[model samples]
Target: MTEPPFELEPIGEVRTPFETSDEAPRQGLEGEEPTHGEIVLAPAFEPGLEGIEDGETVDVLWIADEADRSVLRVRDGERGVFSTRSPHRPNPICVTTCRVRAVDGRRLAVSGVDMLDGSPVVDLKAPLE
Candidate 1:
């Protein structure tokens, strides 16, 4: 049976130089420079940013809304969405583990970002070692 659809409110949004998925690095580690991006948190979520420090690594959960959710197969049509890192999938949820560079109130400067510009940030968590 199919599950009921649900909605999620974004606590923040991603800001990056990449304007299109084609231009973004396939992975955050692909390049030294392309790994840079920022997390712009909403004012209401500002207080929640209290303990996040500059030197810590965090898991950034975002919504890749621009990606084609209808795509189930990719890479020569052999790999299923669940087996590949392709952003196109049944659900366009994307996650990136990144090191914090700086934090200014509700904005966080991070390194190792692979998601597109304006991607909605659903949540942030400490990355497991």
Candidate 2:
């Protein structure tokens, strides 16, 4: 028998100008004008914000909560979810790297965001060199 799925809680949410999914850019840093956004960390996760500052680039990992998780293939072929950047996936975990414009308390201001407003953030990591 398979083990029960693990529960993953959101650490925060992305605040962006894109109110609807269609309004968001398909990819960060490309195919759209420069955009700005903020990551609002939950009170309990505030400590995780330490060391994050301006001029740094971070990879924001988030859950595409509105995506259709049932989608197993896309692009009019039998392409697996892992082969595409399609949000509709089995897990819907997405990543976008943005440059930090500022950091205030628990809020991180960033640029080149492609995520929709109110996207639940799962984690943050420094981009690989």
Candidate 3:
């Protein structure tokens, strides 16, 4: 049976210092220092931020808009796309856990972000402990 199509509307956008994939760390906390970024939620979604607080960890789901969606393998074909964390996949969705540094209105100051600047934030939720 064919599956129905679905669409995702971004609840927010992330602001980071990395402009390109090469500039971003492979993982959120892999660099020498944890990178800081901000998630600016749309005014309509601000109400959903009620319970989140500083020091909490959240799972951030975002789209790798600049990634090559056609890449099916990496590392000289040593691994399939599904076996790796390559951003270049059929669906370039990426997930990372970030610490909530602060929350001011609709903007969340977070650390440990590895996404590129201006990445669309699909969703954010508390990670399973």
Candidate 4:
């Protein structure tokens, strides 16, 4: 038997103008309107972000709370959650590339975002890699 993947908790929430997926941009990298959001890292994980803003862009890891995560067949029905950009799916976790636009104290100002309002932010790292 194989061990299942470990559970992950959200470190913070992603703030955006979008309250629903119907309004969220399809691709986060395609937008460059200088949108900014906060990455309130969990107080316990604050140390992990030390010296993280050394680049102009970064990768944001988050959970897709809106994903359906029920159906398995993806050939039909809007290509199912797996094939569709819809965040509702079996693996709700998602990552997007965002410009670091600016870094202020324990919060980060990011651009090129496509996430929903109050979405959980799991992790962030410089996109230099």
Candidate 5:
């Protein structure tokens, strides 16, 4: 079978200490779970991040941007593709959430990151009511 084609235009890049996926936590934006990473949004999104505030965490949807998409099944092999935090085998796409640490004009300093360095950010939104 022939794989279909797809295209992706990176909106911006993220910076974090997670140099390798092996070091990355099992969960994205573990929040209070104990992680020391941040997300730096592009300057163009400053106006959009106006609503975010300190302690007001928002979900940062990002692309793994560095993971391989050939492996599936959980480590214990006890769950289906639609169950649990098994994004390790996503369809070449990855998403994560981060807490809005601080917003300085167009620069967003956030924590609770689980993505690799220089990852691609797709979308971000404050938690819905």
Candidate 6:
């Protein structure tokens, strides 16, 4: 197999209450209340958070480090990995849309998180128009 063309370095990490996959919701909005979390960006990436206002929605791209990367089918074996939101794929890069509750220096307070604590955040972007 050919090697990947590039490498990904985490610019930050997601801080959530979930310590294990079982503790996390399947989706960000799955629970009765939107899960709250924080994106703690590295000092070098702090400047990139400029102009990101409170109440704005953004896409957070992160690595599912705890995912089972060898699986290509859903747990029920009824659908292919690509056809489902299953994190158990060749590359466990995941994205979730979250609302910014607050922004303080290198930390962003957000809601609608499904990720576990300390998940490496690859990038953050405004939702595509």
- In terms of lDDT, the best-performing candidate is 3
Q: Estimate candidate 6's alpha-carbon lDDT, on a 0 to 1 scale.
A: 0.92
Candidate 3, superposed: residue stretches over 4 Å from native: 1-3
Model 3 agreement with the true structure over 32-85: per-residue lDDT tens digits: 899999999999999999999999999999999988999998999888999998
lDDT value, residue 91 of candidate 1? 86
Where is model 6 poorest over a 10-residue stretch in terms of lDDT? Answer: 1-10
- Local error of candidate 2 at residue 3 (angstroms): 5.4
Residue-pair clashes per prediction, in order, are 1, 0, 0, 7, 0, 0
Identify the superior model by lDDT, candidate 3 or candidate 5: 3
Residue 31's lDDT in candidate 4: 66
Ranking by lDDT: 3, 6, 2, 1, 4, 5
Give the range of the ten consecutive residues with the poorest summed lDDT in model 1: 26-35
- Residue lDDT tens for model 4, 50-91: 776634777888898867678565656646465665566678
Q: Model 6, range 1-129, lDDT digits (tens) per residue? A: 268756899999999999988899987855689999999999999999999999999999999997888898885888899988777788999989998999999999999999999999999999998
Model 3: number of backbone collisions: 0
lDDT of each structure?
0.87, 0.89, 0.92, 0.73, 0.68, 0.92
Root-mean-square deviation of every model:
2.5, 2.3, 2.0, 3.0, 4.0, 2.3
What digit string (tens of lDDT, one per residue) describes model 5 on residues 19-111?
887777776554446565556666776677766788777777777755556656666766654565555565546556666677777557777
lDDT of 2 at 129: 91
lDDT value for candidate 3? 0.92
Poorly placed runs, candidate 2 (over 4 Å): 1-3
Task: Tell me the RMSD of model 5 versus the true structure.
Answer: 4.0
Error of 4 at 30 (Å): 0.8
Off by over 4 Å in 1: 1-3
Candidate 2 on 1-44: residue-level lDDT in tens? Answer: 26669677999999999988888898766655768999999999
Model 4 CA lDDT for position 115:
88
